[model samples]
Target: WDLVCDSQSLTSVAKFVFMAGMMVGGILGGHLSDRFGRRFMLRWCYLQVAIVGTCAALAPTFLVYCSLRFLSGIAAMNLITNTIMLIAEWATHRFQAMGITLGMCTSGIAFMTLAGLAFAIRDWHILQLVVSVPHFVIFLTSSWLLESARWLIINNKPEEGLKELRKAAHRSGMKNARDTLTLEILQSTMKKELEAAQKKKPPCELLHMPNICKRISLLSFTRFANFMAYFGLNLNVQHLGNNVFLLQTLFGAVILLANCVVPWALKYMKHRASQMLLMFLLAICLLAIVLVLQEVQMLREVLATLGLGASSLANTLAFAHGNEVIPTIIRARAMRINATFANTAGALAPLMIILSVYSPPLPWIIYGVFPFISGFAFLLLPETRNKPLLDTIQDEKNERKDSREPKQEGPSMKVTQF
Candidate 1:
C-alpha cells in the first residue's frame, strides 16, 4: 500500500471512501433490484463485483487502487444486500426450520476455513487472487438462479411468477404443482388480497401514517447502533495485543457459541427479548473489558473476544427483528435504508481506532456506550414470535392494537395464516 500510495494518511482516507461507496450501493441495489427483478440485477452485481474486485487486486497506482476499492465496495454491498434479500425471500421457512444453531455453526465453519486459507497463503497478491478469481464461478450457476416470484407477481407479471413457482414446486418434488398453482388461482388470490388491502389504505400513504413512520425512524437508529458496536469491536480486534489469527479464531468460536445460545433463548423468549439481552450483554462485555484490563492484564484478549461475540449475536437479532417488525410491502425499502445507515456506521467505526491516539480507552468507551443505549431501544419494538408475517402497513397497525387487547385462550383466539 505504501508503494502504491506514498502517503500513509491518504491510505486511511481510502477506507472512508470505500464505505461511502457501500452506502450508495446498498440503496441503489435495493431500488434497482426491485425495479429490474432480483435475478437481472444480481447478474450485473456478480459481473461487476468479479471484474472490479480483480482489478482492485491488481491496481498499480494509489488513485487507481482507491477508485477500484470504491467501485468494489459498491459492487460488494449491492451483491450482499441483493443476495440476502433473495435468500430471505426464498429460504425463509428453510432457515427457520434449521434454527440459529446450525446456521451459525455453518458460518463458523466458513470463518475457520477462511482463517486456515489465510494462514497458508501468506503472500498478499496470491491471497487476493485466490479470493477474487473464485467468485467468477457464480456465473457458472447463474442459469439456475430464479427471479423473485413476489416481485414478479406485484409488478403485474403473474404468469412469469407462476412459472417460477411451478419450478420451485417441482424442485420440492410436487408432481401436480403446476395444476395446483395455476395462473387463474394465483390471479384470483392476489386480486382478493389486493382488494382487501386497498379497502384500508394505499401502500405509499402508510409511510406517513404516524405509527409506521415512527417505526422506520426508530429502526434506523437501532440499525446504526447495531453496526456501530459490531464493526467497532471487529476493527479493534487487532489492537488487543495478541496473535491476530488466534484472536480471530477465538472470536469466531465465541460467535458460534452465541449463535447456539440465541436459538435456545428464542425458543422460550421473544425476539425483542433476545435482541435487548444481546445488546445489554454487548455493553457489559465492552465496559467490563475496559475495567478488567486495568487489573488483570492477561484477560484482555478473552474479554475483547466476548465483546465481539456479544455484538455478533446482537447483529443477528437485529436482522431477524427488523424483518419481523417491518411489513412486507416496504420491507425492501426499509432494509435498504437500514443498510445505508449500518454501512455508514461501519465505515465510521474504523475512525475510532484513529481516536485512540488521544486516549487508548476512549474508543472502547465510546463503543460500549452505543449498545448500552440501544438495548433500551428494543422496548419500542413488538414481539413477533409465532405471529403471521405482516403483509401490509395496516396489518402491522392491527397487530400493534391486538397486542394491547386481552388474550383469549385456545381456538377462540384467531391465528392469521399466510
Candidate 2:
C-alpha cells in the first residue's frame, strides 16, 4: 500500500507508529482494566479491534491503512491482555502456566491456519477480515464473562465473585465449588481487612515505596527479557530455510500439536521446571541448528524448524507467568509490559534479517542466545506450583519469607514429577 501510493518512504515510520500504538495501548489498557473491570475492558478491546481492523481492510490510502493498523494494534493488545487475565483466573493453581500458554499458543495456531486459508484464497485484505471476525464472537463471550475473582474479592465483592464461581462450577459440572475456590480464603481475609483497616494503605499511596517499586521494576525487566527472547525466536524462525514461508508453516503445525499436549504437562510438571528444562532443550537444539546450518544444506531447514518449536515453549510460558505475578489492578499492565517488549523484538527482527543478507545464521546465533538467557532468569524465580498467585507486591515479598518450608519427598526435586 505504501508503494502503491508512492509514499513508501513513510513505511518505516508507519510501521513503528503502528507498534507505538500498542505500547500506548498496553499502558492505557492496564490502567483502564484496573480502574474499570477486566470484563468491561475486554469488551471494549474487542470492539475497538474489530471495528478498526475492518476499516484497515478497506483503507484507501497508505496513510489511512497505517492509521488503522495503529488503531488495531492498541485494540488487539487489550483483547490479548484480557484473555491472559481470563485464562489465569479460569485455571486451577496447578496448571496456570500451562493453561495460559496453551491458550496463547492457540492464537498463534489460529493466525497460522488463517494464513494457510489466505494462501488458498489469495486475498490479503479478505484474509484479514476473516481474522478479525473472531474478535466479534469473543466480544459476545466477554459480555457473559465474570470479572477476575481476586479483583472482586479485594474490592469487597466476595458475594458477587462467589456467584460467578458457582456459575463456572455449574458450567463445568464441579460438584464442590466453594470448597475448591480461592474465594474461601478471600472470605476469611475480610475479617483480617477489618482488623488492619487503619494500618493498611491503598495501592496508589503504597506504590511509591522503594521496596515495592524495586520488585515490580525487576519483574517488568525480567518480563521484557522473556518477551524479547520469545518474539526474537519467533521472528527469526522465518529465516531458517530457503523457503522461509514453508518453514513457518511447518513450525505452525508443530506449535498446534505442542499446544494440545503442553497443558497436561504443565498441570503435572509446574512452570519453573518446565520453563527451565525447555529453554535448556531449546539451547541445545539451537546449537545443533548452528552446526547443521554450516554443512547440511538439504535438511538443515527442517532441523532448524524443529529447533524453532523448542523456543516457542518458553514464549508460551512467559505469557502465562506474567499474569501470575501481578495483582489484578496491575495485571493488564504487567501483561502489556511483556507484550510491549515482544513488539520491540518483533520490530527489530526485520532489521536483523536485513543484516543477515551479509551473513546467514548471524540472526540465528542471536536468536539462540535468547532461550539461554531466559533459562538463567528461571533460576531466580520461585516456583509457583500449586501456589495461588499473589495479589499484591507485599504478598510476593513475604510469600517465601513467611511460608513454611515444603517437606522433602526424596533426593530429586518435586518440580518435575510429571
Candidate 3:
C-alpha cells in the first residue's frame, strides 16, 4: 500500500475507506436488496466482490486501490447481510436462531483462516489475491441459491413462492404432503400475507413507538460498541508485544474459540442477556488492561486476548439478536441501519489507537467505556428465544402481549429446546 501512497496521512485514511464504503453500502445495498430479490442482489454482490477485490490487488495507484476497495466493501457488506437474511427466511422458525448463529461461527472460522494465510504468504498483493478468491466460490455456489419464498409471496409472486416451498418440502422428504399441496391453499396464504402487509405501516414508522424507539437506539449503540471494541482490540495487536503475526494468529484463535462457545451461551440465556454478559465481560477485560502496570506486560496480553474473545462473542450475539428482533419485510433495511452505525465506529477505531501516542492508556480507556455502557442497553430489548419471527409491527405488538400474559399450567406440559 505504501507503494501507492508515500504520505503517512493518506495511507492512514486509506485503511478506513473500506469501512466508509460499507457504511454507504449498508444503506444503499440494503434498500436495493429489499426492492430487488435477495438471490438476485446476492449474485451481483458476489460478482462485484470477486471482480473489484481482485482488481484492488493489482491497482497501480493508491487512489485506484482505494476506489476498488470501496466498491468491494459495499459488495461485501451486502453479501453478508443478505445471505444471513436469506438463510433466516429459508429455515424453519425452530432452527432460525441456530442457523444464524452457525452462519456467524462459519464467518469467524473464515477470518481465522484468512489470518493464517496472510501470515504464511507475507506478500500483501498475494494475500489480497488469496482472500479475493473466495468470492468466486460464492458466485459459483449462488446458482443453487433459492430466492426467498417469503419475499416472493409478499411481493405478489405467489407461484414462484409456492414453487420454492414445494422444492423445500421435497428436500425435507415430505413427498406425500407435496403431492397434496395445491395452488388454492398457497393463494389463500398469499392473500393473508398481502392483507397483513397492507395493514402494516412503512418500516420507518417503527421509530414512532416509544418502546421501539428506545430499543432501536439501544441496540444500535450496542452494535456501535461491538464494532468499536472489536476493531480497536484487533488494531492493537502490534502494541501488545513483538511478533505481530503471532499475536494476530492468537487473536484469530481466540475469536474462533469464542464463536464456538457462543452457541452454548445462546442456548442457556436469552440473546439479550447473552449480549449484555459478553459486553460486560469485554469491559472488564479492557479495564484490566488499562489498570495493569506497564511492567506487568504479560498480564496485559492475556487481558487483550480475553477482550478479543469477548468482543467476538458480542459480535455474534449482536448479529443473531438483530435478525430475530427485526421484521422480515424490512429486515434488510434495518440491518443496514445497524451496519452503518457499527462500521462508522469501526472506521474510528484505528484513529482511537492513534490517540494512544499521546497517552498510553487513553485508547484502552476510551474503548473500554463503549461496551461497559452498552450492556445496559439490552435492558430495553425483549427476549426472542423460542419465539416466531415477527413479520409485521402488529406481530411484534402481539408477541409482547403474549409474553405479558400469564401461562396456564396443564397436566401434560411440553418443554422446548432453543
Candidate 4:
C-alpha cells in the first residue's frame, strides 16, 4: 500500500471504485426496496455492511481492499437510502423533516467519533475494524424494525401493512388499535392511493411526465453540484491544516450544527428557498477560500469550515425536499437517480482534488461555480413545506395544477354579474 509518488493516483482510483459501488447500489437498491420492502432492504444492507466492511479491514492486498471497499460502499449507500426513506415514511408529517435530519446527523456524529478513533488508533486496520464492528450490533437489533406501512400498502400488501400499523399504534399506547385499525378502514382512507398503486407503473413513467421529469432533472443537477463541492472540500482538508484530526473534528462539528439547524430553518423558510440560500452560501465560502492568501492559513481554515457546513446543510435539505416532493410510489427511484448523480460527483471529487496539486485554486474554482449556478436554479422547483406527501403521479400532477390555478375570491369579487 505504498500509495506515494509512484502510485499516488491509485488513492484516487480506490475512492473512485468505492463511489462506483455506491452508484450501483443506489440503482439496484432503489428498485429492490420499491419491489420488496424498506425494512427488508435495510436489514439486508446492514448485514452486508457488517460482513463486507469487516472484510475490507482485513484485506490482504490493495486490489482486495478496493474490491471489498466497493462492496462496502454498496451496502452503505443502500443502508442510507433505505434508512432515510423508512424514517420519512413512518414519521408523522409534522416530524418528517426532523426525523430525516436526525437520521442524517448520525454521519456527522460518526465523523467526529472517527476523528478521535483515528487519532488514538494509528493502525488503519484496527480503525477500520472498530468502525465496521458496530454494524453487526445494528443488524442484530434491526430485526425488530417495522416495515413502512406506506410501502406495504402501496405495494399491495395491505394485510401486512395493517398489521404493522396496529403494532405501531399499540406501541404508541392505543389499546384499541386492533379493533379500530381494520383493513376496511385502512383501504377506505387510502382508496385513491390503493387504486393508483394497483396500476403498476414502470419506472420509465417518471421520465414520461413532464413536471416530474423536470423536477428530477433539476434535483439531480443540484445533487451533483453539492456533492462535488462537499467532497472536494473534504478531500482537500489535508492541505488546510497541519493537524488533520482537528480539522476533521471541526468539520464534523459544523456539519452536526448545520443539520441541527435545518429542522428549525425549514419551519420558517420554504424548502426551495432554504436550499437556494445554503447553496449560495456554500458558493461564497468556496470562492472566498480561493481568494484568501496562502500566508493567512487561519482564514483558509475558517472559510473551508464554513463551506463544509453550508454544503452539509444543502445536502441534507436536498434529501428531505426530494422525499417530500416526489410521490411515494417513485420516491426511491427518483432518489436513486439523484444519488447516482451524487455518487458520480463523489467519484470525480478525488480527481478534482488532484487538480489542486497543479494549480491550487483550480479545483475550488470549478466546485464554486457549480453550486453558484445551482443556487439560482433552485428557484424553479416548487416548495414542499408543510405539504402532505403525494402518493401517486396523478396526485403530483393535480397538486401542481392546483398550485398554478388562480384562486377565486370566496364571494366578494367572484365574476360579478357574469
What lDDT would each prediction earn against the true structure?
0.75, 0.65, 0.80, 0.87
Candidate 4: which stretches are off by over 4 Å?
203-208, 293-295, 323-332, 382-418
Q: Output the number of the lDDT-best candidate.
A: 4
Q: Per-residue lDDT of 277-325 in model 4, one digit per residue for the tens?
A: 8899999999998888877878888888999999998888788788888
TM-score of each: 0.84, 0.69, 0.84, 0.88
lDDT of 4 at 32: 87
Q: What is the lDDT of residue 267 in candidate 2?
A: 65
Candidate 3 off by > 4 Å: 1-6, 9-11, 170-178, 200-204, 270-274, 291-298, 319-336, 380-418
Q: What's the lDDT for residue 65 in model 2? A: 86
Which ranges in model 1 have alpha carbons more than 4 Å from their true place? 3-11, 92-107, 176-181, 192-207, 260-262, 292-298, 386-392, 395-418
Q: Weakest 10 consecutive residues, lDDT, candidate 2?
A: 2-11
Cα TM-score of candidate 4 = 0.88
Return model 1's CA RMSD, one decimal.
Answer: 4.9
Q: Give the TM-score of candidate 3.
A: 0.84
Q: Which pairs of residues have clashing backbones in candidate 4?
A: none
Top-TM-score structure, candidate number: 4
Q: Tens digits of per-residue lDDT for model 3 on 356-415?
A: 557978988889999999999888788888778788767877877988899987856866
| CA RMSD, predictions in order | 4.9, 6.5, 4.6, 3.7
Q: What is the lDDT of candidate 1?
A: 0.75
